[model samples]
Target chain A: MSSLFNDDSLKSIAEAYEKYEKELVPEWLKKLPERMEEFNTLSWIPVKRIYTPLDIKDHDYMEKLGFPGEYPFTRGIHATMYRARLWTMRMFSGFGGPEETNQRLLFLIKHGETGLSLAFDYPTLIGIDPDDPMAEGEVGIVGVSVPTIIDMDIIFRNIDMSTVTTNMTINPPAPVLLSFYVAVAESKGVPRHKIGGTTQNDPLKEFIAQKSYVFPPEPAVKVAMDLIEWSIKNIPKWNPISISGYHIREAGSTAVQELAFTIADGIEYVRQLTARGLDVDEFAPRLSFFWDSHINFFEEIAKFRAARRMWAKIMRDWFGARKKRSLWMRFHTQTAGVSLMAQQPWINIVRTAIEALAAVLGGTQSLHTNSFDEPFRVPSEFAAKIALRTQQIIAYETGVVDTIDPCGGSYFVEWLTDEIEERAWKYIDRIERMGGMLEAVKKGFPQREIAEASYRFQQEVDAGKRVIVGVNMFVEEEEEDIRKVPLLEFNQEEIEERQKQRVKRIRSERDKARWSTALSNLKRAASRGENIMPYVLEAVKAKATIGEIMGALKEVYGVYVEPPIY
Target chain B: MSSLQSISEEIKAKRPLKVLVAKLGIDGHDRGAKVIARALKDAGFEVVYTGIRQTPEQVVMSAIQEDVDVIGISILSGAHIHHVKKLMEKLKEIGADDIPVVVGGTIPLVDIEPLKKMGVKEVFLPGSSLKTIIETVRRLAIEKREKEKLLT
Candidate 1:
C-alpha cells in the first residue's frame, strides 16, 4: 500500500476510492443510474439516496440531537464516548458445565474482556432440570446448562459477584435465573443493589423470533414485569430487561423493522409497568437494547444512530423520563449470524470485522463478534480467540473510537438516520393501530412481515440485483476442505445422573415440612395475584430447586401452549 | 388425502421420486431445517414439516399418517449418529423400516462413512445443492421401495 497521506497527488485518488460518482460524470450519467440499480444492500436503501441533510430536514438539532449525557442523548450516551472511557468491551461467553463456563469467564477476563454475558443451554431457559427427558442429549451442548441454584453457584464460583456485570441471555426462565443469581449473591454477602447485570427478558420477541420461550404470552409478560418491579426495588444496578431486536434481524427483518419492532416491544413493557404504577424512570434507566450488526456498513451505522435519536425522543416525549441515563440508548451489538455462510467459512472473519466496524461507528456500548467457524458449529477455541482479537484490534489499533460518532456528519449517515427513523415510526404507528406488539405478534403480523422482507431480499439476490460476494456474485469455483473436530464434549449421562443424585440429596436433606410450607406460600402468592418474587426468594433459601419453584408457579399460571406461528 | 396423492404424483412425475422431510427428536434449530424444507418444497416434493421437537415415534407415525414414501431426518446437536440409528431401529420395531431414511446437518465428513454403514441412504451436508438433494432422495426412495417389494 502506498502512503497516500504523504503524497498530495495520491490523496485525491484515495479519497475517490468511495466517490464513484465523481468518476461517472456526464458521459456516465446515462449508464450510471442503470448500473446503480444493480447492486444494493438487502435493506434496499440505495447508495446515493441513502443519506443527506434532507433526510433530517425537519429535525431541530437542539431538540432532537442534544449533547450526550443530557436530555435527548443522540450524539453519545455519556457526553464523552471514549474520551471518558472506552465502551465496555464485553464478551458473550458461556458453555459446558457451570464450572467450565466459569473457568472460561476467568480466561476471557484475563484476556481483557471487561464485562460478561451468559448463554445458558435450553434446559435452563425453559425451566427444566438438566435430567428432564426434553433436555436429553442437549446438556452443555449449545450453551451452558444451569439446572438449579447449584448450577448458578457453579457458574459464578470464585468470581466477584458484586463487581462484575453479568448479562444473562435467558428469556423464559429469566426470572428463575435472576432469582438464583440473587440467592447466590446473598450467600456471597453481596448487597443486592451492588450487583449489576441485564437479563434477556423481553418475551414479546420470543414469540416473534428466537423461539425458546415457555409459558403463554400473557403469563410471560406478567413474569417479566414481576422481575422488573422486584429489580427496581432491590437490584438497582441491574437492567431488568434487554429488549432484543437482534433476533428479529436474524429472523430476517429489515433494518427498519428491527428498529420499529424492538422499540414497540419497549413501549409495551413500559405501558405494562406504568399501568402497574411503577415510575418509568425507576426502571426505564435499566432498559437496555440488543441489535444485530451486519455487513451493510452505513445502513447499520445509520440504524444505530437513528435508534438512539428515536429512543431518546420516545422516552422524553412519551414516558417523561427526566434522568439522562433513562433516555440513553445503551446497547450491545453482535455480528449477524445469518450473514455467516457455511461455504468458505473463513471469509466470515472479514464480514465480522466490517460488521463490528459498523457497530463501533454506530456507538455500541458493548459488542460480541461472531467467529468465522460459527456457521458450521459453536466456534472452536482458535476461532473464538480470533473473534476476540478482532475486537481488540478494532479498539486498540483503530482510530475510530477516538472520535465519537465518526459518521455523525457524513451526508450518507445523516440521511440514513432520518430515513430509518421515519420508516420505523411509521411501522411503530402501524403496530400501535393494531393494538400493540404483543397482539400483533399473536396475530403473526410481525412474523409475516419479517418473512416477506426476507423473501424479497432473497428474490433480489436470486435476480442478481444484490451482490453477496461469495453467494451470488464474485463466486469461487472450488471450496477448500473444512477440518472436523469433536463437537463440545460433555458427559451428558453423568451430569444427569449427578443431577438425579442432587435431587435426591436435596429432597432428603431439606426440611420437607418447611419446604411444603414455603411451596404452599408460593402457590398462594401465584394464585392470589401477589408479587411472587418474595415468595420465590423464600423458597430459594429453602433450597427449592428451579423445577420446584417453577412447578408451583406452573400450577397457578398453567403451561403455555403456543398457537403455531403460520 | 387427495391433495397428498396429487402432490406425490406430481413430484414423482416431474422428478424421479418423492421424499417426505420430517423433524425427529426435540431439537429446535429449525432455521436450516425450514430453509431446506422450503427448498425441497420448491423442488417439487411433498415436504411434510413435523415442526419443532417431535419424537421418533411421532416422526414414524407422521410418515404413516401422511403415507410419506421416504423419511428425511435432519439432526444437528451431535445426536445424528444415535438418533438416526435409533429412529431406523424403531422403524423396524414398528414394521416401517421399509421406508428409506436420509440424514443431514452437522455430520462430520468422517462420521458420514459410519452413518452410511448404519443404513442411512446418504448424508446431505451443509451447502449441498437443493437440486442434488431432491434428485438423490428420489433415487434412494425408489431403490428402497423396489427392494422392499421384492422382499415381500
Candidate 2:
C-alpha cells in the first residue's frame, strides 16, 4: 500500500515540525511553562502537546480509512451518515410497574424519541418473580418489573412493535426475556420476521463487568448463543446480541480495555456459532455493539472510530465474513453515567451535553444522553425531557451532522484512533492466547484489570491529580442539597404487590397441563444441548412465569457463583 | 509521615481493625464497593468482602463469623431501604448490632437521615472523599472496639 502523502511532502512536514518544536517550544515554555507536570488522558495514554502529519505519516488513506460505509470502516458504516437520517434517540427507561413503564415509553415517543430501550428491575433482570423472597424490596426499585407475558404485554400495549425498534438491556436470562417479547408481539399480530429489535444477550461481559451471570460459564454462553442462532433463522430483522462495552466502562475499565475486551467477547460469540457449523455471514450482520461515550472528548470519539475499523478487519480477516453488513460494527452509544457528579447536580446537564456531542461526532447509530438528575435518583419527567432535548439540539441546531466523519482527518484524532486501535489489539491477542474471553474471565483477568484501573482513577481524583470540577476542583461552596431536587420516587411495596398479584393471576388462570409440559420441554432441551428458544416461547405463551422457567433450567445448568475478589 | 499513615500506625498499635465490606441483594454494580474495600485495606485495616448478591442473612452471618469491627454496606439499587432494614434486624437478632454499619452509593439525600435513624453510623453519597470515609471508619472501629472491651 502506498502512503497517502509523498515522501517529499512528509519529509518537509517533519522538518517543519522539528524546527517549530526545537525553537518555538523552548521560547514558549520559557514564557509560559506547561501547567501540568505530565499530560495524559484519563486512560493514562500520554498525549503530545500537538500532533502533525508526521505523527501519522505511515497511514494510507485507502487502506487505513476508506470512504464511509466501506471495509476497514474507519470513518463510519453509513455513507450518508446523519445527513440522510439522524441517529436514534433511545433513552433507556423503566420504573414502577409495567403500565408505568409503558406510559413512559409512550411519552418519550411523543416527545420525538426514535427508538426504545427498556431497563428491567433487579428481579426481572435476574429472572425472578416479584414475590420471590430474594426480591422483597427490590421489585421495581431501579427499573420496570416484568416477570411474565402479562407484564410484557402491558409494557408494550399501545406501542407498535413492527415500527419502533426496541433494545432490551438484559443478559443471562436474555432468551427468557426475548421469549416474553416475541410471544407478546405474536399475540398482537406481528409476525416474527417483522418484529425488529435487539436483546443484549452477551453473557461473557456479565462475567467480566456486569456481574449478572445466572448459569455457570459454559452453559451460560451456550444459552446466549442459542438466542443468536434462533433469531438468525427465525427473526431476520432482529439483532440477537449487542456485544457491549458500556457496562465494562461503567464497571471502571479504561476506554481501551472496553474496546479490546468487548471485541474479544464478540469474537467468542462468533466462534460459538461457527463451531456449531453455522456460517459466519449468516449471523454476523446482526451482531451489534453498545459503547459508553465518556467525558474525554477526543479520546471517546477516537475510541468509537477505532472500534468500527477494528471490528471490520477482524470479521474479514479472522472470521472471513464476506458481506459488508457482516463486517460493519453498528453500535448505540450512551453518555457515561459514572461521569455524572452528585455535587452541583445541575452541572450534570452540561457534562451530558458535552458527552452527547462526542457520541455524535464519533458517529453512533443511536444515542442516549443521561439525565442531569441521575446522580440523585431516577430521572424525573423534567430531567428525561432535558436529556431528550439535548440530543435534539445537537441534531438540529449544532450542525455537527451536516457532513460525515467531521473529525476523520484531524491529526490528533487520527493519531489517537491509531494509538487506541494498536493498544486494543495487544489486549485482544493476549486474551486470545489465554483461550478467549471465557477463559480470561474464569481466571479473573479482565475483572482484575478493571478493579486496578478504577482504583487508580479514584486515587488520582482523591490526590487531586485529576479534576472532577465540583468534586475535586473549583470547590463549590454550599452545594445544592440533593433532596430539594424534584426526584422521581416509587412506592416499592405497592409496585411489588401489584406485580406479584398479576403473576399469581396469570399462573392460576392458565392451563396447568400446558405450563407444566412447556417447562419440562424447556428443561429437556436445555439438558440435551438443544436450542431452548422455542421451548421458552412455549412456556412464556403458556403463562409460565420467568422464575419457573429459570428454575427448571437451573436444575440442568446450575447457578454461577462469583469468586471473591477485590 | 503523612497524617493518614500516622492514623494507620495508631490503629495498628493495638490491632488491625477488621472491616467487613459487603454488597447486599441483587445489584451487580460493585465498583464502589471494591474501591472502598481496597481503600480501607490500604489504610491498614483488614477488609473481608462478601462478593456480590449476598442476602442480609449471609452478610450478618459473615460479620459474626469474621468478628469484624465494622460492617460497610455498599448498595446502589435503590433497594437500600429494604436491604438496610433487613440487615439491621438480622444484626439485632444475633446480638451483633454493636458493629458499626456505614452505607454508601447512589443514595438519595432524603433517604440519608432515615438510614442514619435506623442505626447507620454514616451515609456516604457520591463525591464523598476517601479521607472522610477512612477517618469515619476508624472512629467507628475505635468505638466498637471500646464497647467490646466493656462487654468482655
Highest-DockQ candidate: 2
Model 1 stretches astray by more than 4 angstroms: A1-26, A29-36, A49-60, A458-481, A484-504, A563-566, B1-27, B74-79, B103-111, B122-152
lDDT of 2 by residue, A139-212 (tens): 98789999998888999988999888999999987988998899889999998899988999989899898987
Model 1 agreement with the true structure over A1-566: per-residue lDDT tens digits: 21212345345545654365455454567665555544455576556633334434455666655666766566778778876677676777766678778887888787777888897765666777766676666666567777667778888887899899989998867777888899899899998889898898999998787777677788889988998899889888988899999999987789999999999999999899999998888878889999999788888998998899889888889999888777888998999987876666678889999999999888889899887766555666667777788888998898888877777767667767777888899999999999998899888888788866765665555566666667667666665534443234556567556656665677679878888898899899889888788888778777777777778888888876544332
Off by over 4 Å in 2: B1-11
Model 1 alpha-carbon miss at residue A442, Å = 1.1
Model 1, global lDDT: 0.76
Top lDDT prediction, candidate number: 2
Cα error, residue A290 of model 1, in Å, equals: 0.9
Task: Give candidate 2's whole-model lDDT.
Answer: 0.92
Which residue pairs collide in model 1, if any?
A52-A415
Interface RMSD of each: 3.1, 1.0
Q: Candidate 2 has what TM-score?
A: 0.98
